[model samples]
Target: MKNTEQFIGKRVLVVGLAKSGMAAAGLLHRLGAEVIVNDARPLEGNEEAATLQALGIEVIGGGHPSDLLERGFDIIVKNPGIPYSNSLITQALERGLRIWTEVELAGLISEASIIAITGSNGKTTTTTLLYHMLNIGKKKPLIAGNIGTVACTVAEKAKNDEVMVLEASSFQLAGTENFKPHIAIFTNLYDAHLDYHGSTTEYLDAKLQVARNQTAEDFLIYNNDQEIVRSSVETMHAQKIPFSTEGKVVEGISADEEWIYWLGEPFISTKEIKLPGRHNLENILAATAAAILTGCKKTAIENVLSSFTGVRHRMQFVREFNGRTIYNDSKATNTLATKSAISSFKQPVILIAGGLERGHSFEELRPHMNNIRTVVAIGETAERFTEFAKSCGVEQSLLATTMEDAVKVAYESSSEDDVILLSPSCASWDQYPSFEIRGDQFIHAVMKL
Candidate 1:
C-alpha cells in the first residue's frame, strides 16, 4: 500500500455522493486528508452525507458551488458516472487539480492482485464467471466495480493473498491516471456509451486504460476477434494472450463448432455450456483464458463452463410455458446486444423490443429479423422498432401499452417450438430506472401467464 502520510493535511473534495464517492471520502479521512464532499442532490434525508458529516468530513449538498473550486483542494475524487461534461469537473480540470475515480484510489491502496475486465458488453458476465472460476480453484477472489461493490471498500478489506476481479466500465476507466490491473481482460468492444464519450474513438481509448499501467510481468487476456479490441492493444506492454471464436490463435484460446481450445488443446465442449448465444460463448472463452493464465485448475474451469447458467438480465432464461421458452435479456441496451440475443436461439423468436434511444439505431438489428417471427414493441422506441422490423421483412409487429401487454402478446404470438425473447434494443431509462428492474418486471409478467 502507498503511504497514507501523503494525504495527511491535504485538502480533498469528493464529487457525487454515490457508492464510490462515499467510500472515497471515508478512505481519504482515514488516510488523514481533510475531506469535503459535494453532491448536487439535496442534503435532507441524505444518509450518505449525514454519515460523512458524523465522521467530521464537511458535506456540501444540493449544488456544486462555484466558490468551492477556489477552496484550494489538492485533489478531487469524482464518481465515474458523473460525466466530464459536468461543470464542477470542468472547473476542477481548468484549475489544474488532480482528478480521479475511486478505482484509481483502489489501485493505490490495494495489496491484493487485481484482475480487471472492461468492454462495451459482457463485462459483468465475464467478471462474474472469472470470480466463480477462481473461487472453485480456491483463489479467494473478491468482485467489485461496475457490477455494484465499491472498489475502495473492497481494496481496504482485501487480503494480500486474495485476488480482486473488477468489472470496469468506460466511465470507471476514463478517470484513472496511474491505475493498473495485474491481469487485464478486454472482452470485445462495440458501439456503446457514445452519448458520454462523444465518439467511438474516445470510448475505445478509455477502455484501453485497463492495460495502461501494466508491465512486462502482467498479463492482458483479450478478444482478438474484435478488430477494435485487437488494434487498440497492439503495442501494449503486458504479455498478450488472445481468445477467439473465429478459428485458431497461435498459443491462445479459440473455439470451433463444438469445442473450446486452449493453447492448442481442447479445453471444454460447447455442448456443456448452459448460457445461450454465440456472444456468451465469446464471454466464456475470454473468462476461461484469463482463468487459465491465473493457474485455475482445468477441472474447475470445466465445472463452471458446464454448470454456470448465466448472470441475471443478460440472456437469462426465465421459464418454459406451454412449449415456448421465455428469455429475459433486458440488459440488451444496444442494437448489437439485441442482435446477439435474437441470433442465440435456433427456434423462431417472438422479440419484445424498444426503450429509450441513446442515439443508436435499430438498423443493425434489421439483418437478424429473419429469425424473428414477430415483434412486440414498448416504451419510447416502440414505433421506431416497428418500422425497422417491417423494413426488415417482418410480417407481424404489435405495439404494447405496457410491459405486461408486451409479454402477453409475445407469448400469445409464439408457438410451442418458438422462443419469447425480451431483448430490448434500447436502454430502460424511459420506463424503468435500470435494466435490472426492467428484467424483473418482464419475469413478473411472464409468471402471471
Candidate 2:
C-alpha cells in the first residue's frame, strides 16, 4: 500500500455491510480513518458488525437514520449493490461529498498493475482464462473483483511486481473515480442491468469507466465486432488492441475456422481450444490479446486453451453418464446467454430452462431452439418456456418446481448421444439466492443419477 497518508485523519462512512463493505471499513480504520459502519439489517446477530464494533469503530444497524449524513463524514465507501438512488447516496451527491466503491481504494493503495475486464457477458470467463494464462506464463498474477474475491482485499496484499487480474462489474466500475487499469479488456456489451442503471445508456456509461482514466502508456484490448464498444473507445488515450471473431484485424487479433491470429500472424490452432461456444471465441481472442500484451508465452496460452473446459456454472461440462453428456450453464440468466449456450452444440439437447419472471418475452429464444429435443422448465418462467418450446417444434416439454426435479425429468427425456443442459434463461432469485447454488443443486442431482 503506497498511499497510506491519504486516509490519515479522514472521516469515512462504510455503507452496506457485505464482504466488500466490511473489508473497506477495516482497511479504512487501520489507515487512521474514523470509520462508522451501517447496514439495513439488524446488527444484533450480525457477526461482521460485531467484529467492527470490537475494533472500536461505531456500528449502526436496523435502518438508516435520516440524519446519518449530518454526522459530517468526509467520504462514503459504499457497497456496489447499493444504488445511487439510495437515500444516503443521493444526499451525499447533492452535498458534493466524495462517494466511492472499495475498488477506488484498491487502485489508491495497491502497488500491483491492474488488468481489469468488464462487459455484459464473458467477463468471468475472460478473467479466469487470463489468470490461468498469466499463471502458466509466470506473471505473478492475483485474481480479484466480481469473480468472488473483493478487489480491496486482494489489492491490500498485492506486490508491485504482480499483475492483478480483476473481473469488474458495471456496478463496481460506476463508483470508481481514479481506478484505472494498466491493461483493460472490454469483452462485449449488451442490454443488461437496466433496472439498476435506469437505461441502457447509463449501463454502458458505467461499463466504459473501466478505461476512462487510462493514459497512452496503457493498453486496451476491446471487442471490435461490437460497434457500440468499438466506437466508444475511439477517443481513449490507451493504445487500443482490437479482437474479433467476425473479421480479421491486421493490427490486433482475429480468428478464422482454422486458427487464432495475432497481429496478422497465426498464434494458435482453433482445434487446440477445449472451451465450447462461438461466443467464447470472442472471449478467447480478448484474453489471448491481453495475455500477449502481458508477455505470456504462446505455449502457455495454448496449454490453458487446450485444457480449460469452461468456468463453473458457465457452460461447464459435467461427466457423461448413461451415454449422455451433461452441461451446467446456470449462469445463463438472460436470453442472449442461453442462445449462446444452446448454439454451442449440434447434438440433440434436453434443455432445462426457466427461472425468475421479469416480464420479458421468450420470443427472442424461439429462433435458437433448432436442436432442442426436450425442454424441462422450472421456476417462475416455467409455463412461458414450456409454451415457447412447443411453438419451436420441440417434441417434449416438462415442468418441474425445483432444480432437482428438473434434472430428473431432463435425464429421463435424454437418450444416447444427446446433451442434457441446464441453461436457465432467467435470474435465480425466484428459486435460489444465487445462480451458483442453483448450479450446485443441478450438479448434485446429476451425481445422484
Candidate 3:
C-alpha cells in the first residue's frame, strides 16, 4: 500500500456538510483543491450551512449530483453519519473513485498508531478510560471519533509514533476503507442502529466491517461475553483476542475471584477498579485487552481504573435529594443497555423511561420489572412503554405528559434509599437533538424541585 497525495490540486467532491464535512471542505480548499460540499438540508439556517458559508465553500442543498458518478472523483470525503448503501456513494465507487470516510481520512494523516473501539454500548466509557490511562502515563493521546473530534480533523495532525485513540461508531466504520488500527476493540453489541441498518444482522455486519479490511498482522481485542460480536467477527486475518467474564485465553483477558486477569508479561490481577457496574467491568476487560496489546502495563491500567469516575450519563449519579439518588442514564438508547443500567442498582428503582422508540420490543426487559417501584414514563414512547410495563405486572406506572412532570412524579413516588434513574431505552429525537440535552433537562427539572 502506497500513500497517494493525489488529493493535492485535485478536484474533490465533499459530501455531507456537518462538522466533519465542513472541516474536510475547508482543509481541501486550503490545500489548493476545488472543494464542492453537499448536504440534504434545503436551506442554510443551521450551523453546518453557516460554517460552509463562512469558509466560502460552495454548498449545495439536497443529495449528490448525477454528474459526480459519471465523471468520478479524485477523492470523496464522506461524513460518518451517511450510510454505505447510499446510491450516490455507491455509484461513485462503481466509477473507481476513491471514497474515504472522515475516519479513514484522519487515519491517513495520523502519524501515530490508532486504538479504535466500537460497540453498541460502553464505547464512550472505554474510550475515556483509555485516555485517562494515557494521561496517567503523561502522554498526549488524541481522543476522537463518535464522541469528540471526527477522524479527518485528527488525520491532519499525524505525527510519527503518536497514539490516536478513536471511538468509532458503526456509522463511521461503515464508510471506512483502509482505516486500520494497531489495536481494534469490540465491546459488546446488542440491538441498536436498526433504523439505519434495517435489521440486526446488517447492523452487526456493519460493525464487524471494522475488522473486515484488516490483515493477520493487525491485532483485534474484543469481548468474549458477546455472542453476537464473537460470531460476527469472522476476521481471522487479525489475531483474535477475547476479554471475558468467563473462559481462559492464551493472549486474552478476563475476571476471576473479583480481579481482572491478563495473559501478558506483567500478568497480574486487578484488585480494586473504581468504575461503576458489572457492565463497566466488561468495559474494563475490553480496555485491558487493548492496553495489554499496546504494551501498557497491567499495573498502570489498574491504577487509572481505580480512579476513573466513569463516563457521564452511563449510570451517572445526578444528585441526592430527600434520600433518593437520581442517575441520568440518557445514553442507554436501547433496551439491552437499559437492562444493564437497571441491573447495576440493588435498591428498588423508580425508573423514568420512554423516548423516541426505535421499534424495539420491550419483551426482553419486561421480565425484570420486579425491581421497579414505579415507572414514570414520558416522551413519545410513553404510551407504548407504559402499556408494556402494565402487561409485565408493573402495578404502579404512570405516563407523564412532560419530562419535568415525569421527574416530579418519580421523585415524589420514591422513598428514601430508592434510586430514580432516567434510563430511556430509546433515542431522544422526539424532543431533543441528543441524549446530553435530555439528560441536562432532567437535571434542571430535578434541581428546580
Candidate 4:
C-alpha cells in the first residue's frame, strides 16, 4: 500500500471482537482512526476487552447498532464471520461508506514483505512451513493471519526487512479489494466453507482474490494438482508460478517422485522432508516455490524443509494407547482433509470423526474402506457420519458422547496393528474454542488411556 494514504483520522467501524477485530480496532485508534468497536457477545472483562478500552474506543458490547447505517463512517472493517451481505453493512455501503476486512486493512500498513498461502486445506501447514523457513532462515519472519497471529498485530510492530508469512482464509479474502502479497500461494482447493460461501463457485472466487489484485511484478504460486485452482487461475492477472505433483511448470515449481522442484530446479527431496502425508509434501512444494520466488537459495529451501516440524492439531502424532498408535488430527475440519489423513496411514484405523457440521456430506470419505477398521463418530454430526460410514459397508461404526469417550472407545476397539486416529472432519466449535484446544484435550485423553 502507498504510505501517503493512511486511515488514521478516518471514522471506522470494527465489527466483532475476534483476534482480528480487536487488533484492527486498537491499531486504527493508534493510527488516528475514530474507531467504534462492537462484538456480538459482551466481553467478559478479559485482557482482550481491557486492551480495547485502553485504546479509548467506545464498545457496543453485543450487536451492531441499527444507527450504524444512519450514522456515517469512513469504512467498515468487518470480521470474517460476519457475512458480507449483512443488511446493516449493505445499507452502510449504499449510503457511501466503504467496507474492508481487517486482513485487507492490515496488509496496507505492514512493513514486512508478505508471503501468503491460501487453500481449503494445507494453508496452515504451508504457512507454518514458510514461517519456519524464514524464521530460522535469518530469524526475520513472523507467521500470522488465519494460522498464527492476527496480521495487524504482527504489522504493528514488524521490522521493515523481515518477511511475514500468512495463511489467508477465503472468508478473509472474499471482500478484499487491494491486499497485495509479494509471493502468494494457492494450495489445493477443496469443497469447504460452503455454509458461509453458499456455493463452491463463490468460495473458489474468494480464494482467487489472493492473486486477483496482484500485478505482473508480483508472483502467484499455485497448485497444479488441483484442477479447479489450476483452471481458475488462468483468468488472474498476476505472473503465475504453478507448483504440483502432476507436472512441473516452466519457471515455476513441482514435486517429482521424492523431490521438491522449484522453477524447474529440484530444491528439496520429499524423502528428507519431515512432514508426514503427501498432502503435506504438496504444501512444502507450494512453500518452497514461494521461498524460491523470494530469492532464497535452493539449499536454504532444502535445509528448512528437512528441519520444519508440522503444524499442531494437523495429524499431530499424540501417543500410543495400550499398543494403539493415537493421532490428534482435530484440525482436519473437512472431509477432504480427513480423507487425506486417513489415506496416508497403512494400517486399518479406528477413526474418530465429526463435530459442528459445516455443510460437508460424506462422499469424499467413502473410498477409504481398506484402511479404516471402524469410525467412532461424535459431536453434532455424529449420526450423519455414522450413517454414511455404515452405507460404505464399514462393519464397526459407533458414536461416542465426547472426545474423551471417543478416545476411550477407540482404545478399546483397536488392536496392536490398528491406528487410533482422531481426525475429525468438522469444526471443533462443538466442544472447544479452537482446533488447538481440541487437539490438546485429545492428547490429554489419550495419555489417560
Name the top lDDT candidate.
2
lDDT of each: 0.89, 0.93, 0.78, 0.80
The candidates, ranked best first by TM-score, are 2, 1, 4, 3
The sequence of per-residue lDDT tens digits that candidate 2 reaches over residues 124-209 is: 99999999999999999999998867999898889999999999999999999999999999999998888899999999999989
Q: Give stretches of model 3 more than 4 Å off.
A: 1-4, 42-58, 84-87, 198-201, 213-217, 247-250, 264-271, 297-299, 357-360
Query: What value of lDDT does candidate 4 attain over all alpha carbons?
Result: 0.80
Model 3 weakest 10-residue run by lDDT: 264-273
What's the alpha carbon RMSD for model 2? 1.5
Backbone collision tally, model 2 = 0
Superposing every Cα of model 4 onto the true structure, what RMSD results? Answer: 3.1
The candidate 4 region of ten consecutive residues with least summed lDDT is 1-10
- Colliding pairs, model 3: 111-158, 216-237
Which pairs of residues collide in model 4? 8-32, 8-33, 252-263, 258-270
Q: After superposition, how far is residue 261 of candidate 1 from its true place, in Å?
A: 1.0
lDDT of 2 at 425: 90
User: Which tens-of-lDDT digit does each residue in 1-449 have in candidate 3?
Assistant: 12436457787888887788877787677666777777877754667777767778777776676775455457887877777577877787677787767777676667777889998888998898887777566456778887788676776775665678899888878766777887888898877678787898888876786677677888888877777777767644788888887755557787764566677333545556665577888887787677666667656777877777657777777778999988889888888878888887788999999998668788879767888989899888899898888887776889898789989999888899999999999999998899989988888998988
Candidate scoring better on TM-score of 1 and 3: 1
The candidate 1 region of ten consecutive residues with least summed lDDT is 357-366
Query: Candidate 4: deviation at residue 355, Å?
Result: 4.1
RMSD values for the candidates in order, in angstroms, are 1.8, 1.5, 3.2, 3.1
